[model samples]
Structure formats: structure tokens, C-alpha cells
Target: MADPGLLGPQRRALILDLVKRSGAVRVADLVEQLGVSDMTIRRDLDALARAGEVEKIYGGAVASGARAEEPGFEAKTHLASGAKAALADAAAALVEPGSVVAVSAGTTAYAVASRLLQVRGLTVVTNSLPVADLLRDNVADVAGTGPTLLLTGGTPTPSAALVGPLADQAIRSLYVDLLIIGAHGVSERAGLTTPNLAEAQTNRALIAAARRVVAVADHSKWGVVGLSAFAALTEIDCFVTDDGLDAPARAALEESVGRLIVAGSAEDSAG
Candidate 1:
């Protein structure tokens, strides 16, 4: 019988499963079980850390566990998969190298961060833990080549965002080339909104600190008003959304925002 060596992702999947079952996994054990070297195990851990799949500690890795109070970050990744991917790709294309950018906390923004990972010489300031973790974990790949990652340290919310006064204070004074934000909902009545009031305030500060504001939301978010509104429709420079948006809503948004970009199709621009 021939030995079938495991591939990278396959090996990583097994490692993740082991971590989940054991709560924590040791490097020595993984090396022995996978028949790989200690260096290979460490590299796998590093990649998993970058993807927010596991928490890498000094000796080994730990599984991600969600508190009863907060929604698990892993769960959010599954929502609006296609729409978020399209929106993220479109948004990432707008980011130029060496640009100063701000990304707010949300699954959609997380998607954008994933795409922006390879962009070189970008100075990214963000309030999302997942975004910060993604960039930080990729430090080796981006060393001297990728963006300088900055986090707005502050109070954390149920969604894993650092918000409140500390985040607001940091954002109010700085300036960035572009700010990308995801909203709970969008409507003619309520511009851009989120369920969290503190997040709303923090987002307003982000809007004020940037030269351009690009709002990313899927069709499902349309007309679903949240508890707080951050910015008015006219205040947004460009609105990026998925093709799932209906023609009438698209027309209305085009009339409202400075420009409207529908991902996965020719843009419907209004300037």
C-alpha cells in the first residue's frame, strides 16, 4: 500500500477538528499524528490564525469559542455569501496601493478585508477585531509589502467591533483616503443604520474622518431600518450593492447617493 500524504487544506481541516474536540491542540502531537515536521505544524497554525480559524498561543492552538452573550464570528461568515463576495471584490478594486483606508466591523467588511489582504503598502485603520486579526496574522506575507495595520482599540460589542468613545475619539481626528462601511439596513427614510447606538456614533466619526465614504450592503438590507442611523443617503460618495437589488430600489438609490455601483454588472452611476 502506498502512503497518501495529506494536502495543506486537508491537513489544516483535520487539525481544526482535533482542536475543536480537544479544546486545544499541541504542536508535538500534530507533528506525530500528521507525520509532518514541527515547522510544518507551525506554518499551518499561522495560516489558520490568519483566517481566524484558531487562536495560536505560545505552544499550540486553541479552538474559537463563542460566549453565550455574543454571536459567534464563524456564524456570520455564512450569511450573504455570494452577495458579500461580489460586493467585497468590487470594493477592494477601488483601493489603491499606499492608500490610507478605514474598514468598519461587519461580515461584509470582513469579506472586503479578505480581498484587500494582498494589496501592498496600504495603511489600514479598522475597528473590527476580525479585520485586525486577519491583517496581523498575515504580517509575514505582507512584511514590507502590505499595508500598515492599525486598530482603534475600544470597548467591544456583541459583533466583535471595538466601538464607543475610544474608537470615536481615534477616528474623529484622523484622515483617510477612503472609508468602507457595512450597514444593518438602508432606506430612503433612514440613510445608513445599525442596531447598536454606540456603533452608530462611532461610524459617524468614521464618516467625518474620511474623504470618501463607500457604503456596502446587500439587497436584503434595503428598507430594513435599524435602531440608529449613521449617515444620510446624500452624504455617501458611492453605494456598492449586489445584483439582487430590484430595479426600482436601485433607481431610487441612484437618485439618492452621489454614485451607485451594482456589483456583478455594469455600474449604474449617479454623480
Candidate 2:
């Protein structure tokens, strides 16, 4: 049992730690473990949920998966920086000059956009405001000429993505040679997923508009499941990720995906 004299913050911290470690915690269990009343435990869970630290479910709380909470775009920019850069570089390598490409919204996709500025005579379609701003502001400095850029108009998401019916409609009418997408979570079971349902639909539209789809995510994305699944593993033409992934996970991806490219590695692995 936890210390009976523990204050509110300390008790809540303990509850959060337990939920994170075990993936979930029943209210009854938490009350007993923390030596608190059921009502008190419930309050703690509510506070954690409001803070985006845990997801509350019937009778309990669960770890904050991508399905439970999505961090803001700026908040995610600092995470896995080197891995994201490597993944972006590898994803950029797949695009040729004069090719039309669609970029998705997310920090990793933003990295890919930075690299695409160097590729000349390209048409870029996207629903990410940051990506549009990045390309518009800096493309000319990197290349003598900038690629044709199109930004799909729609409602803005916390992750800086424009998603909804309007974004889907715009994407459906156009076709691109490639789509470089980022995922909130990646797992064999759930595939590419996002917490936002509209973003999932928008991502599906982006997939439909592309002849070839390449997904870029860091190793940390593996095995995380979000609320909505956008595409299955087999749907991607190529998956580019950092070398931080484990051998077993890499092997599993190789078996499921058409091609698995581990950035920073000496050689690429094909399925």
C-alpha cells in the first residue's frame, strides 16, 4: 500500500506511474494501492486524463497511447530528432526531380519537406500548413526554382494538419507520383494510425491519390496503436525508418512491407 499521508500530487504521480507501467489500472486496484478512497482515485484519474497523461476508460485508466492523446506539432518536433532526420533523408532519396509528390502532416513529414526543397521542378501537394510555409519561405534559396506547391484547404488540427471533407475532396481529384506520410503510431495489427478520425480519412485520400506511398517514421513509432487506422503495412510501397529499430521488429516489417529501408544502415532490406 502507498503511504496514507501522501499528498494529492504524489498520489496522482504514483497512479500515473502504475498505469504507465502496467498499461492500465482499475479504479479499485488504484484505491487499494494508493490507500485512498475510490472517489479520490477517480479524481486523480480525471486530472491525469485532462493533462493528457492517461486515458480514462470505464472503471479504470489506461496508458496514453496515440489513440488517447496527440501532442501538438511543436511539442513533437524535439523528440527523436536525429532519427527523424535520417528517415527524412532516406524518404527524400526516393523522389526524383520533376516528380509530383504529396507530403503528409507531422514533424517527420516536415523533415521530408525540408529535403524536397532541393529537388527541382516538382509539384507538391499537402495539407500541412507548416510544410506549405516551409516550402514557400525557403524553397527558392535551396533550388534555383521552386516546385509547384498546393495546400489543401480545411480545418486545422493541433498537429498543424488540415483535415476534413474538403481536404479529402482536393486530394481525390489529383494524383501524385509519391506520398510521403508520417504516422502517430505504427503496428502490424493497426498499421498506420492517428488519434484524429478526420486526419485518418484525409490520409486515406492522400494514399488514394498516390501511385506509390512511402511512410516515414522513427523506430519509436513501432508497436504503438492509435484510434484510427489509415493504411495497412502491405499498402505502403516502402517504409523508411531509423536504424534504432530492433532486429526482430525489422524482420517483422520486412516480412509485411514490400521494402524496408533502415536509414543510417549500410544496406537496405527488401521483403
Candidate 3:
């Protein structure tokens, strides 16, 4: 149980955090954890619901909206981190030096950007604030001039993505040799989906402005349909994913995508 003297707002905030992390929180558990009466906990949940922070269910509350279930930047970084790193490495290897590349905003895309720090004589465009900051800070070459980093301006989403009409407009006039995108979910049927509608709209622009599209995702993304489908599986030139992806998914993607690279395997197997 939490401290008896804890404030109401603080308790509600704690409950919100828990629900965001775990997807749902039971009223009974909240009552036990907060050391409050059932009625009090329900009142708190009701308040949160009224505020549109959460959706009230039978026994508890879930995330507010379908897209609201999308994990924030910090939360996603901890999920399948090792696999994401491997996928990023594989995806980065496909980027040729001196190429103009656009990297979408996601934890996996951030990982890919981290690996591209040493890719000299390149121009990288991105809609992710963290990705731009990472490249600006760590990039260095013999001439002390690193990649030309371009950032798209827009409203920031929960995933730290700059997504809106501004981002779309920024990408319209530009063309890139490659674009690496990460998804909230990927499946044979639903294709590449994302929880955020604005991000989805921005991603569509990225795809349109690129000659080649490489998608980076972990095995866990398979079969999880998000709120919006941004791109179909056939739109991807190369799909880089962890070796943990099941064979059936690999088979389907291999047929749909132009190429598939499995990271953390004995070899970079093509699907």
C-alpha cells in the first residue's frame, strides 16, 4: 500500500502510470495498493475517466483510446531492446555511404540512427527529435564534418515523433535514396501499422518521398494490429527483423516484401 497521507492527485497519477505500463489496472489491486476504500478508488478512476486519461472497464480502467495504448518513447525502449539493437545493426548495414536517407521516428529507428553515427558523407533526414540530437552529438569524421542531418518540424507525439501536416509538407519536396521505418505492429494481413494517426500520415509521406523503404521491427510486432495501417507489406524494399520471428511470418513477409533480413542469426538470412 502507498503512504496513507499521499495526495489524491498523486495517487491518480500513480494509477495512470501503472495502467499505461501494464495496459490495465484492476480496482481491487488499486484499492489494496493505495490503501484506500473501494469507493474512493472508483471515484479516482471516475475522475480520470472524465479527464479522458483512461477508459473505465468492468473491474478497472484501460488506456483511453486505441492509439493511446501506444507506448511512449521511454516505455518502448525497454521492450525487446536486444532484438531492436540487432535489427538496427542489420538495417544500418544496408545504408550505403553518401546516401540520402530518411529515418522514421520509433525506438527501433532511434537504434538505427545510433548505429549510423559513423556513416560519414551521408545526409540523414528524420522526424525524431532524439534521433537528430543523437546524430548531432556523436557524429564525427576525419574532416570533423559528419552527416548532414535534416529535421522535420511538427507537433510532437508521445513517441517523440514530429508528426503533422508540417512533417508531411517538409518531406514532399525532398527525395531520399532510402527510408527506414519502424512500426507499432506488423502482420501479413494488416501490414505495417501504427497506433498514432498523425504518425501514420507522416509515415505515408516518408514512403512517398523515398526510392526504397526498409522496415525495422522486432519479432514481437508480428500479428499485433495497431489503430492505423500506414504501409502494406509489399511497399517495403527490405524488412529487417530479429531471428526470433516465427517461420510462418517470415514466409509470408518473404513473399510480400522485396527482401527480408533476419538479425541475431548465424547469418543474415534472406527470406
Candidate 4:
């Protein structure tokens, strides 16, 4: 009986969701985006803090540090149930009918790869073993026919990515229409980040090869910055995310990107 777009309580839910993705946010930004008083925004933050969804910092709030540890496939698979599905859907729609799409290695990329099976005449180049495995194993069973799947060769990370000079070199010569990237953390100021240096270089290679870059992330990716910077948000053309994103987080991403696609929403709005 309540619309998040209209109700204050629902609005707080949206804000909390945004804060969760973004590690930290300033109070001023929330106030302006929510079109509410400082007190109202503070109350919203207070509620989220009480609920253990976010912890209040000096200037703003951030998500609880419950899952910062690098999780395995089985682990992250159960983490954000609906958000991952929604992110996958959004990432999948961006793939063209007949095109070369390079999928980066990560849990989010795996989701995108799984959804991309719906498309015909797709050549998927990826560095994730699980991604190739998913494509290789299901190409016939899915009935869409086999699109050329290129697996990058390199040293593998615990997260299942092939990251090294060999993989980077292979990615250099190739080109693709779209690149669906997965990130450990995404921040407006810090851009996209990860813990692995090789993976970061490979991500750079992916960014270089693709005509358009689309960052696939749920609300959990926002605000958090990692050791290595993958790509500046400005380098990306589009961002595919779930509807849980707050207006400020969307706006922050929009500043770096030209278009934003909210998962499950047909609407495309500018920042």
C-alpha cells in the first residue's frame, strides 16, 4: 500500500539501499536528492542504523561490513538473491542479437553470462573459467546454438578470473561491441576497484577493447573502494544496476556515465 517514490518511510528504504552499495555518503547529498529536510534525512539514516543495515559515520552512513570478505561462487551466489537476478537481467538485455561481448570474470559477470544465453549469434570472450564452463556446458542444452566462446588464458584467481600478461595480450588485439564488467567495489570518486592487480590490468584491457562498457553491479558495490582502480566511471558508457539504488548514487554514477539502466525498469533517465 506504499510507493517508495511517494512515501517517506519507503523513501528511507531506498536511501538505505543506496548507502549499502556505496560504502559511505555525505548528508548533504542525501538531503538534496531526497528533497527532504536535514532532519528527515537524518531520521532515515537513524532508522537504517538501528536496523543494522547501515552504520552512521561522522558525516554520513555506510552499509554494515557483513560481507567484505572475498566470497567464493557458492558464497556470493546466496548473498543478494533478487538483486543479482535483477542485475543479470539488466546486463543480459544489453547484449545484441549478433555481437561480440567480452564478459569479465566475477560473480556478477557469471550472472550476465547466464542470462546472455537467451541471445542468438553472440560471441562471448571471457576470462572466467566458470563463465566459459557455463557457456560451454549449456550451449547445446539452451538451444540458442553455440556462439564462439573465447576463454582468456592466464593465472587464475580464487574468484575464477584469468589474469596476467598473456590474458591481457590476448584481449588487446580483440574488439567487442559491449563489455559487461564486474567489480569488487565501485565508488564515484575512486571509480571501480578490486584487490587483484592482474585482474585490474585485465579489466583495463576489457575497457580498451570494447566499444561500450557497462558496469554490472547491485546496490552492494557503491561507495566501497578497493586496492586497485579498474576503470574510472567516466570510461563506462552505461551502468546496469538494481532499483534499490538511491537517487544520489544514481546521480553519482550518471555523472561518470551517459546512461543508467535500473534493473527491471524500462525507463532511461539522465542525471
Candidate 5:
């Protein structure tokens, strides 16, 4: 037994975080992580369920239909520190100088924007506030590298992201060389998914407006499936992920997509 009164709000937040990060979490894992009883975790989940914060499944919970399970921008900014950085570098490598690129909204996308600071004489169009902020913040850091930045104008999401009809319309006008997207989940069967269907629509617009599509994600994004999908593996030009993908994943990528770049670095930290 555990004390919900003592860990009430904190417990809810912890479970929510795990649900978002892991996509779905088992009851037993929650008990161990929170040092709480299964009953306690269930109660916490029930509370979140009543609020319509998450949808309870047989063994776990996933983001609700109304909103993404992802936490606020601040929470995402600090997660998977080394992995995000490594993944970002791998993503940035795919971009050639002077090319027009469209980046999607997500912390991992923001990380990609951070590394793109040095990609001089280029143009970047994005719908992410954090990514725009990162591009502006790192301008000076990019002494020899600078790009012309363009931001999509629209209403912000709960995550303070820009997406809606206006953003979609804005994105529709631009035909870019490459569009790099971020996904909450990337599965071979379900494809690239996100919790918000509207975001999915906007992402689909991005995919349609670009010549080549690249998805930059970490290993955590594997196995989870969201309500809405953006593109099938066949539509993607390249899939850039860490080198830790298992044999099945590698085979799946080979069987499904055109090219899969398992961003192998000299100092690989995929483990």
C-alpha cells in the first residue's frame, strides 16, 4: 500500500510522464518505478482517466484522443539528453548547405534545429516555437554558419506549438527540398503516428509539400502507435535513427523503405 495523499499530485505526474515517454507502460513497471502498490498506481490512473487525461487500456494507458500524451515543452527539453543530441547530429548531417528544409515541431526537431545553426546560406521553415527560439539563440554560436529562418504563423497547441489551418495553409505554399519530421511513434505497420490528428494533418501537408521526407527520431519512439499517421515507409526518402536497431528493425526498414541511415558515429552512445 502507498499513500496517495502524500504522493497524490506527484504520483499522477510521474505516471503521466512514464506513459508519455514509454508510449505505454506496464502496471508492474509503474509499481516498481513509483515504489507504490499496484492498487495505488491504479487509483492514480483512474484519477487521470476521470479527468480524460489518458485512456486506460487493459495493461497500460496511452494519450487521450483530445490531446497528445506528451508533456509540456519544458519536460521534453530535458529528456533523453545524450540521445537527443546524438540523434540531432545525425539528422543535421542529412541536410546539405543552401537547401530549403522544413522541420516539424518537437523537442527532437528542436535538437535538430540546434545542430543546424552552422548550416550557412540555407533556409529553414518550421512550425515550432522552440525550434525558432533555438535557431535564434544559436545564431551567434554559428559564427561561420547562419540560415534564413521562416516560421509558420498559427495558433499554438497545448505544447505551445504552432499548428492549425493557418499553419497548414502556410506550409502548403512552400515546396521544399527536404522536410524532416518528428514522430511520437514510428512503426512499420502503423507508420509515423502522433496523438493529435490535427498535427498529423499538418505533418501530412508538410510531407506532401516536400520533395524528400526524412524522419529523425530516437529509439524510444519505436513500437508505439498513435491515433493518426503521417506517411508510410514507402513515402519516406530516408529514415535516420541511432545504430541500436535490432535485426528485425533493420530488416523491416529494408523491406519497407528506400534508404535507412542508421547514423553510425565514431563515439556511438546508442546503448
Candidate 6:
């Protein structure tokens, strides 16, 4: 039985471990194992679902599986907010001033774009409408010293990304110093994936146009798989994610990607 004295985070961690190990965990079983109330177990499950760590079912929570359904941009923005911010900070640190960087579509990529505003002389190419709007609106804040922004014109996706022939063609024509991207799902086998085929193709174009690629995803994205694979894990030069990733998943990413960065660890250590 789990220690009854365990705090909320510790209890949640144990619950996540159980779900990861068995692929699913029934609410009643969790209550019995963790020595928590049924209401508490439900609350924990709700929290985990919000973090994208698990999929809630009728009486239990299951490990995230292949997610072919695409969530709208606004819907995704509310999930994993803390993890996304940490990921954004870490990913933005990899960019240098005056470098031409390609930012892909997603809430995480939009976070990275916000952080990039401090990096003077940057030239950003993107297919994300929010990223473009963010940079354009803040032009005066940097006293006209903000990064030069380029937006690819294409058919808009539900995620607010412009994709298709025009986006692919525009991305392919220019080379970028780095590519900071987010994926609908990331896995060892499937790599970076998305439900939208055209977005997948456009993401591939962004990867091809960059000298180095950095994928910023939260720990919750670890085992999730999407319908279409865009870039392989081997193609990612660096992977930045929050510290919620479990040990096995972390080891797997270390072996697959060129480098793995767990955000928030530094701050945790410093504190």
C-alpha cells in the first residue's frame, strides 16, 4: 500500500507510475493501493488528464494511446501550461541572436516565440498565425529591434497553422539556423507526428530547411502517437521537455535523440 502520508504530488506520481506500468488503472484499485478516498482518486485522474498524461475512461485511466483526433489550438492552449512555459524557456535558450529560426505550429512553439522576443536580431519563419500575430503586435516593445518575421501562406488548419503546397514550398526555399517545433505526439517508434497529413508534410519541410532541429514537448507527449509521422527521432538534434517524464521514457529519448534537456530541473536544483 502507498504511504498514506504522501503529499499530493507524491501520490500523483505514484498513481502515474501505476498507470504507466499496467497501461491502465481502475479508480477503485488506485483508491485501495494509494489508501486514498474515491473522490481523491478521481481528482488525481482529472489532474493527470489535464496534463495530457492519461486518457480518462469510464472507471479508470489509460495510458495515452494513438490520438488521431486533432484538438483545436485554443483547446490545447489550456493543457500543460507550466510544462509548456518551461519547455519554451529551455528551447529559446538554444537560439542565437540574428539566427534565422523556423518555429512550427503549436502552443509550445508559440511559447518559444514569446521567449524569442528577447533575442535581438532574430529572423523567424513560421506557419503559426498566433506566432506571427505575437511578433507583429510586439514590434514596438522592442523599439523596432525585434526579430524579422515571415509567415507562410497556406490553408489554415484548426490549430491555426498555415499548411499545404504554399507552406511547403516557402519552407523549402530557405535554410534556417534552427527549427523549434512542437508535435501532436512524440514517440520512439513514431517520432514526431500529427493528425493532419498536410501539416505533417509541412513540418517535414521545416525540418529539411533547418541545419539543426529542436523539438519542445511536454512529458505527457512521450508515448502518444498521432496518425502521420513527420520527422523521425533521429532527426531531432535536441529534445526539450518538462521534468514530469518518467525514467524509462527519458532513457529512451536519450538514446534516440542527439541530446535531451529536461526543463525545470535546473531551477529545482538551484532552489
Check candidate 6 and list the clashing pairs: none
Sliding window of 10 residues with minimal summed lDDT for model 2: 59-68
Comparing 4 with 5 on lDDT, the higher-scoring candidate is 4
Q: In candidate 4, what are the lDDT values of residues 2-44, reduced to their tens digit?
A: 2325576788777876765655555777877777778877888
The positional error of residue 68 in candidate 4, measured at the CA in angstroms, is: 6.0
In terms of lDDT, which candidate is strongest?
2
Displacement of residue 205 (Cα, Å) in model 2 is: 0.4
Model 4 residue 181 CA deviation in Å? 0.6
Question: What does the lDDT read for residue 122 in candidate 5?
Answer: 82
C-alpha TM-scores of all predictions: 0.72, 0.78, 0.74, 0.73, 0.72, 0.75
RMSD of each: 17.6, 8.0, 10.8, 12.0, 10.5, 12.0
Candidate 4, TM-score vs. the true structure? 0.73
Q: Put down candidate 5 lDDT per residue, 43-156, tens digits, no spaces.
A: 988999899878876555666642237567787777666777877888798899999999998888888887778887889999989888877777777785787889998887
lDDT of 1: 0.83
**Residue 115 miss distance in model 3 (angstroms):** 0.9
Q: State the lDDT of candidate 6 residue by residue for 27-70, as single tens digits.
A: 88888898989999999989999999888765677676645567
Model 1: per-residue Cα lDDT over 198-220, one tens digit each: 88899999999999999999888
> Where is the poorest 10-residue window by lDDT in model 6?
262-271
Give the best candidate by TM-score: 2
TM-score of 2: 0.78
lDDT of 2: 0.88
Question: Once model 6 is optimally superposed onto the true structure by TM-score, how far is the C-alpha of residue 72 displaced, in angstroms?
Answer: 1.1
